[model samples]
Target: MAVVDHAPGSGHRTAGDPGGPGPRGLGRIGAVPPRRRIDPADGLAAVTAWRTASDGSPPPRPVLATAVRWTLAELADRYPGGACEVRVPPFGVVQCIPGPRHTRGTPPNVVETDADTWLALATGRTTWADAVATGRVSASGERADLSGLLPLE
Candidate 1:
């Protein structure tokens, strides 16, 4: 299973378990904390500013978080599948691409990266191949390549 900061707080203590690292340490077998719904429109403003900034600097934390989650949601909506799990820690995670869905344990296809890299990929600021070459992404499984569906601007 993926261990992401977006799942829950670091202290993963569960009732009836002392915590040893497993389902018990995770607070539940395969449960993730609910994500805070962010309106994409709100993020669009920040993204626009970020894209055109003279300094090429990122937006503030809240704004960046909004953008990351919105982009992840947009990707999920576009792909509409559970074959690949894309994760951006401290911000978002989404299941996308079309193929077989995993019912238990770690998914066969997974793509994990930081929010900055994800935003770059979601927008047209960077390419999948470039990010992969630069080691900005960790993609596993055949369906994890998202180049076809990116530049989602």
Candidate 2:
């Protein structure tokens, strides 16, 4: 398990520590809280904010990165198996769709796309077929078709 320590005088509670500042009455002294997991809602918020921006400009790198990571991670969680490798370069990759697991070498099923294209597909701004037709996505293998699992919203 990973741990996170609050700074001194931060008044945060630590697990199993008495007399702390938080509701649990645990003090920050020598506290080793578990590391926070990435929240998918946070990532979705980032993407939504970028998509709804009035200026119609591309999202900042950090926001885009967060959105991509969240969506891909969500897919992995939902599918819960490593039969397909989904790749969005420079952002995130996850193995999903239940079938044969690839432990070595390139996976039999692979899908690759740029961050923008992925974000578009994930947010329902674009469809998988349209993206493929426009040459925005490159997919291989029998299970590479993610049309049924896209627009993760």
Candidate 3:
């Protein structure tokens, strides 16, 4: 089981991702939800909405927000243009670094990849230089050189 540290004042808890049922997640995959007679779709919709929403609100504690935030912060720091520059397709698009901004056509620097790959890079599971070197990620332009910052977490 993975060990997680507790917040300074909160009670200790573990939510899945550790070897047992998580408090708010789908427990054990097949075990019934704590509440009775609820449609499965509702739960799925909630999680999906939470994942896609743009409110910038953090997910509830004892949830996956730690990993998510870690991923975002890592990406934010690693990407040269900062958090406002990079752009992802479905999950997020942020910009990083300080460079001449482009308004039309392709910006001289651009990096595009799928969500999973981006998440992986953000979480330190992959490296920007390695991903680009391996041809798994596409990078273009001089200012677009992200070797200085990458693999967020």
**Candidate 1 clash figure, as a count:** 0
Estimate, for each residue in 1-153, the C-alpha lDDT of model 1 and write its tens digit: 865443345665434444544556545666565666666678687676656652576567877777788889889988899999999998878898888998678999999999888888988888999999999999999999998999897
Please give the CA lDDT of all the candidate structures. Answer: 0.81, 0.83, 0.53
Give the higher-TM-score candidate: 1 or 3: 1
TM-score of each: 0.72, 0.73, 0.45
Q: Go through the candidates in order and give the C-alpha RMSD of each one to the true structure.
A: 9.0, 8.6, 17.6
Q: Write the per-residue lDDT of candidate 2 for residues 88-118, one digit (tens) a residue.
A: 9998888999999997799999999998889
Q: For model 2, which pairs clash? A: 20-25, 20-26, 20-27
Q: Which stretches of candidate 3 lie over 4 Å from their true place?
A: 1-85
Runs in model 2 deviating more than 4 A are 1-36, 53-55
Candidate 1 segments exceeding 4 Å error: 1-37, 52-57
lDDT by residue for model 3 over 1-153, one digit each (tens)?
A: 867776744745446444434755555655555522223354334344445542477445323333333344445545545313454554445456776766556577777765556555654567888777777667677666655666432
Which candidate has the top score in TM-score?
A: 2
All candidates in order of TM-score, best leading: 2, 1, 3
Best by lDDT: 2
Task: Rate residue 127 of model 3 by lDDT.
Answer: 80
